[model samples]
Target: MADKAAAQEFDILILGGGSGGYAAALRSVELGFSVGLIEKGKLGGTCLHNGCIPTKALLHSAEIAENAKTASKYGINATFDSIDMTAVNSYKDNIIAGKFRGLQGLIKSKGITVIEGEGKLTSEKTIEVNGETYTGKNIILATGSYSRSLPGLEIGGKVITSDQALKMDTVPKSAVILGGGVIGVEFASVWNSFGVDVTIVEGLPSLVPNEDAAIIKQLERAYKKRGIKFSTGIFFDNVQQNDDGVVVTLADGKKFEADLLLVAVGRGPVTANLGYEEAGLTMDRGFVITNERLHTGVGNVYAVGDIVPGLQLAHRGFQQGIFVAEEIAGLKPVVVDDANIPKVTYCEPEIASVGLTEAKAKDKLGAENVEIQEYNLAGNGKTSILGSSGLIKMVREKDGPIVGVHMIGARIGEQIGEAQLIVNWEAYPEDIASLIHAHPTQNEALGEAAMALAGKPLHG
Candidate 1:
């Protein structure tokens, strides 16, 4: 950095302008710090442009198509029509464009120095972007992540990752998704609802192997009834793709072919060749290793978002960025563990969970000291009206505070705010049951679950 030309300096220089980078910038400026945020891409990174917002928009379209198909079941006489690829793409693009513009405006309003160039960590205190050096009293690395593909497998033509799948104009007649995780299942739900014959292959035994077993069972059952085929407990050995599509071979010598194969295996950290390891920062398989407070132990540098270990979620990135900003300001923000972070899967019969899973609860507490309860959504008026069936499962220490809340049902993701509060605050079941929840709403299901867990059992 000393050998470089005269460079600009700031109180904080944040690399990457994704959820984490931009978030840190906004919060840092709020704390009266001169912040510089560097990015080579759009202001809002993957989440705004590619990952969360756009994918959810696509899923919303899929939901509308499904609802139209089943309108008659609700006594509304409506005919199911075909999905116009052009209109769908137009709608998706518009949502992203609007959000992107708003985010850019927000960043500009914060009076942040937005440097548009590819940035490399030149030293513990400086970032070099396009041959221009920017030094800072404190540095934050939040380069974000990229779609990852399995080794020996290539993405092109008929085989694609989430990036290509999002921009797909025409829905394939049939699709096979590898990895039964959040990304894979969400796309499977969307493609299946669009009338595309869909199948998911996972090496794990359950679709969302991280959730409680009961929730997983309900999801598998729902998918089965929805005519979505899935093969679990088997890993794909290889994939062969041509102009005609791709065939995936399983480790058991079984093969499945589809018009297109989507590899939703997860995202990899974008810490390669950008001088992360070269700058004395510890690296674990390309992820920047940071301490509990997001400190990199390399001078005044820190790491946040997908580049840091734990949950690779956009909101988590936002929270971590804010926390880091506050920490630098001497505010000493509380650290949020990944377990307490709310996790929502936006697929049909959407899933949401916070805090511990049942298995985890039992492991942390004594098995005999963990109490559990499930309230079926059938008892909720809103759920029945929506013709959705699932249950809210709650886990707690015996005669103690609620440790977890998990749910699977239509639009259940919306209920996670209350659930996260319950779990993160360690509220007892009775504490929630004592509160008034509005009637005739899906939210009431959570209250009812709490009631049952409190041993009141007002409704089934």
Candidate 2:
């Protein structure tokens, strides 16, 4: 009910210009709607600025360092020098800067108004920023997330989170990672390749517990071989930091001391103090609760990205943003199942999976109603040539369609495109088997698994 005379109005108003917000703006504009995007930080938000882009750049640098360390094994004479942190960080910054510039250009080219300031929801369809009101017919909430910590475990000094880890000028000599989720495992891989002694403590029984059990086994084996130590099924009791380092004591009285301790537990939704409750939007445990269609139960309001729960991924945010825009445009976008969303952990041996796990499939269907086929990468000519080992496991309803595909190997994350298509499209094993994968490629392993599931094993 504030005066509308001085307020800016648009067809769509987006909050938090992250993956979801920016994507919603772009898509809405493309659909011939006037859009206004408000952001507190850089346009890219956490994914581009802190979380995804920067971390992936570090992971790629880690891969280069690892490859150099093993260059002699490939019959190439090259000295593996110590990692130059300055140079490595420069590379990461360069990539981020370029992407940031491009995003700014795209926003400008799309003719969307970009407002720079913190925005608070004043009503169901209005956001107040810097003493100015922005109103839209439809509003999309895409406030992202932040790194989370435990009750007593604080992040300061040597006890850090991924955000701090990303900004560190020098890699620690030794580090203890608090969680074994995607973020934890990724940092562990990077630090290990940088010659740090890394130990991961996971509360679950296995690292990357969300992945298929077989994939977890392979990852553990690979981590062990890389000398990356991990303690699973143990909970940390407390953490103490001193002049020397940080010590993490487990519930069972075991202690681990390292130069730094990284708390990679998970990310929590940043829905606090944003006036969501004031706007009558329901929230649970800090996450905004949205319906299958992403409605916020409020008039003309929708939520997307990490705040909306389900998969806390940037790409998922992108999809949801686009979907919400299309829905607002009366396009009636198809609802995507969260289970069909592809997940990839960029650790040493990357773990990528789409659709249900074997256990989940068996639980959903009867154990006898599902069939699983695992094709070892050892049989794949490309993997063997690269001296890497992994497996591609496909899960399907008995004599029905392929419901899941899980993979673990070097550069295997690239194959999730085909895997997700197969699962999301509900393609039968025989359907994929009829297709051809090029010779001596890592992708051939997926095709091999499909063929084996189709009852014709080319190279079992």
Candidate 3:
């Protein structure tokens, strides 16, 4: 250690102790590089405090609520009870708290210097935090994101965002959710299960617009059956909130008045006044521009996670962090494309996919050079026993490897691991079909789809 008069020096200095930053810190230390991690708030960041972990916890609680109501169908005598937000919040908070504590311990064990306070990139290799200066050979910007709202529409009172939605103690009787993306639909499922009348407004043609068409249609069907109303292909014109409630109007002059309006539009990167642009890094609408290898092209600076303008997933950030650390160590890891990343939606009827959609595959390989096959979950014994119905669609090159896999159903997200491996490894249908799948398992549906694609259909 140098004299206290000089700034602390490190091999790698990271701003933002979120999933990505902390991950890079951990890995960098393991590679024998001294690391300095900086954070303004909690170490776990949005994914742990507000985004993935908390939202998924609420979704799980919603699942239990749904299961309780439908328990009679399974011959189980159970009385459905009301939701207690205080209790629910406690449970969710506990999960996050435990994880946060574990993360803190892990970082401490790794011996990385976790600088706790707001940090800004003063230069390519230096960061200033809380009246202190830390210089490093390399720098990483992992500043995450925040809940975004439409222009001219404020977020307060009756008009709230996911952050407020998670902390709500009293449940609203009716809620009009704006935007039908992942956040919108997931909240819809949760609120609906909690006995609230929920309606979603989406400008896209269907719910989960980025998903496969088949999955979208299946989700629409399930939402309709579940009494979750949605107005698709219509843009919201205006929203006005008062002490009583909110009135949401559409472009076509349709109005939905509800006790609250949830603006589930999306999240915007948090790279505003952290001195990124001042340091000469490329910026696009608050997102930092990075190369395929995640370098900023200005010195040894790099940016990862939500600020990089690709997928804003926690795992994606985690992997990128590891990749950046390994890259700095000269390990030269195999590049992971955004397309190969697995996407999972934790709604009532979950959706999961990896690689291309059918349209995308056909577009990439030409329609004639591609092949498609699907296996309905109705025929799967496990799905039938669970009283769920959906299907798995597989996209492939003609006489070649599987290029994509999309699925929708109860707990279908659990099947994404196998699908991701198949797509990422470019496995042929026969290769998966040749493997034995346990009977009466949800995983059997994937194997059945593979079998069909291999010209050896078995109970498809």
Candidate 4:
């Protein structure tokens, strides 16, 4: 107690109680360091509130409605004539609130002090929050990100960001999404199932430009079959809201009209006006420059998560937070492998991938050394039973190991858990193919792909 009072603060003071911040706080405390966490809003951050959790809840509702319509083929007759947005919003809010409460409990159990308000980094080892000055030996900047809007398209009323999309009281009759990235596509899947006419305008040549070219083609077909429209290789020029709806103009001089306009171009780090400039930390292209050890140019200071760029994900935040905490405790934790981090986009036919894509693999290992083996879900008994179809592509090096894995299918996001293990472990095709997979499961697609890469396939 004397030592604690003599300190007058904490060993570690972290800003932003997002996924990364909370993880840092908890891990720091567990490692025997007195920790302090400051957050302006909810504990779980954007992913739990506006981003991952709420969007997924809404997507699940869309999926339930879709499944009900197709229930007759499975020997059951069910119909969904109208969607209840009120009920959906209620369900979404309840789940989000419950999760937030759970986060608060977990933080409390770890003995980490959490403060409610924005935290401004005052110096290398101090933060100011809620009219109180907190001193610490180490400070971490984990302030995450917010949805980015176009230059000409302001977000409000009929034109909104994903935050507004999550709590919409009434379902729009039609939606025109700007930017065919993960957010746009996921919303497309959501509103389309809600009987809204959805159109995606992408500045890139293909939807999910970061994905494999083949997977993008498969998604294009699937979305088209579901009555979603795509306007790829076009940019949004303007967004104007009238009494009736919103009208959007494209770079190609085309016009699109919808009840709502969603600017899902991307997100930017929330480092603006948070005293980062006053501290004089290094920043590169709107992202804080941090070393592999998660330290900034300023001593006793570090930055993590979206603020540091490269794979803005909640799990990555957790890992970085843990790493920084362990490092500060003098435990010398193993450096995090960013490549091992998995990414998932929840839509009708979800997209999930870990490690490299075929293009990325070929660039690294040379075309001759790389090989891509694919298994179509149409050939999988489990997928057929589920009335879903897609493909799984595995990237391997010439008799080496699986370097990348990409998947597209209904509920395929769930399968990424195993796919990531194989990629991260650098397991050879023969290594996985030698093992027996349970019969009639979507996971069999992975097994079959491994077999094909091993020069023998059960189903191709």
lDDT of each: 0.92, 0.93, 0.93, 0.88
Candidate 3 C-alpha lDDT tens digits along 272-324: 99999999999999999989999999999999999998888899999999999
Q: Residue 98's C-alpha lDDT in candidate 1?
A: 94
Of 1 and 4, the candidate ranking higher by TM-score? 1
> How many pairs collide in each candidate, listed in order?
0, 0, 0, 0
Q: Candidate 1: what lDDT?
A: 0.92
Among all windows of 10 consecutive residues in model 4, the one with the lowest summed lDDT is 1-10
Which tens-of-lDDT digit does each residue in 250-317 have in candidate 4?
Answer: 87789999998888989999998788878989887678888889889797998989899688888998
lDDT of 4: 0.88
If scored against the real structure, what TM-score would every candidate get?
A: 0.98, 0.98, 0.98, 0.97
Per-residue CA lDDT of candidate 2, range 348-377, in tens? 799999998999999999899999999989
- Model 3 TM-score is 0.98
Candidate 1 residue runs with Cα over 4 Å from true position: 1-7
